[model samples]
Target: MTTSDDEEINPVTMLLLDQKDDDVSQPNNNSNIINIAEVVVPTAVEHQSYHLNSITSTLVIRQLPSQGLSFQLWPAATTFVKLLDSYTPSNTDPFSLTVTNAVTSVNCRQRLRILELGSGTGVVGIAASAILGADVTVTDLPHVLPNIEFNADVNKNVVGTRGGGVHVAALSWGKVEEMEGVGREYDMVIGSDVVYHDHLYEPLIQTLKYLLLGDGDGERVFLMAHLRRWKKESGFFKKAKKWFKVDVVHEDGPSGKSRTGVVVYRFARKDAVFR
Candidate 1:
């Protein structure tokens, strides 16, 4: 029988219990029985680890129920991280200098300053730090900071070794005070799976307007990755286009199957148009 909503059962444990019960009811004389102690008990905390091949760094994350959606590693995050890895200097060592020089000139900095909004498990930010050697600030809601910090701490050594670091901070989009607290501008602003909520459209764009560099130089970049879920979610892109030029930079989905609707967009201020 299936368990009710109020009750939960581990599929592995349930299967083992069913087998034991069947063995007990059988008429055949059999002394052998499965050892209960051998069964592994599931833990409350879920631990996930990802290895970034480009930087040769590993990220360890521990998720909790309190943070809701932020507690788990999302597909968009993985996809963006893979995109970063592909562009990483290490992957193109011989041709890296040319790319690095262009990126540095655009940002006018030796190292990139990156800000990731709604950085749930800090995967993308941490990977950026380790792979690009960019100083990254991973920001999210106040309640999500603990796990973000934990993930940052676990990967601190790797980030440090790469000459990059991560800072965990609380940032609620559209909040004046919070927006003011974040620095004037960042070389690159990145986020994944942050556009799922319909109500956050205005605040998120407002926050982007405040933090994104509007110098009209096109030096700064805002990269966002999200899975297209609802038709209404397109409104975010529509609203964002008013202030920034949005372009699809990358796309990937399962092969020989329907499109997965995962896309990464690169946004930059429309210099001639921006007020």
Candidate 2:
């Protein structure tokens, strides 16, 4: 699984190659093996390289079957990275400037500890590490860890060059013990495209509650870039309102497509909530 300095590994090709190796060992009588390309939406792993704040980082991503939507590179992830990249500590930009000032002030001697929930392809986390000089941990499901780890490795040099660091881990929503094991608290929690599923709403809220309010550090906030796909997704916000005060920090419909919505929100715990 080692990649050379100039090369980036492709996730889909690696998976198909593994399947082919399996087929060679145990031949199936049924010749109709499913082509992953047809079943998966994107069908291929996209190698995306972004140059932000004079640092370049690359990510390998693929959409796999039955693994939910964690494989592909969504627009929300890209938007989140762009938002992070656009900020500087001296800038008057509201949201990004606020994040930069807060994190930098709190983490003066050491790098800021940032945990990205549902870090598909690890793009946003990697960018945050490289561009912002923060120590970022990218977390997702166990099945998604391999790709996330791979991308982290691929961009390790880039992050290191910027005096930042990256780590990858598996974090399932609503798992209190797992959350406790990962770390006590982070300067910030981030996610993108994680609000689609209706069933995940409550679990996601619980996870946020722990990360933001579980410990005594109520200063922490959840920064998220969400794509408004279905109307039902609004329920996530409604449920989150009970424990968190949510703010739409930024919003835009890219390329003038009014129907396509992308928003960046900041979530902080309510004053009355005592953990």
TM-scores for every predicted model: 0.75, 0.78
lDDT of each candidate versus the true structure: 0.69, 0.70
Model 1 lDDT per residue over 142-188, tens place: 98898889889988988886688899888999998987787655667
Runs in model 2 deviating more than 4 A are: 1-43, 56-68, 256-258, 272-275
Candidate 1: what lDDT? 0.69
What tens-digit string does per-residue lDDT give for candidate 2 at 1-275? Answer: 44443332222222121222221132122122345657733333344445565454443333343444576566678678777777766666556754864576564677788899999778889888888788898999898989788878877777887788998888889998878778745888899978866788888998888888775767788889876656556678888998898887788663322245578888887762312
* Cα-based lDDT at residue 238, candidate 1: 91
The lowest-lDDT stretch of 10 consecutive residues in candidate 1 is 15-24
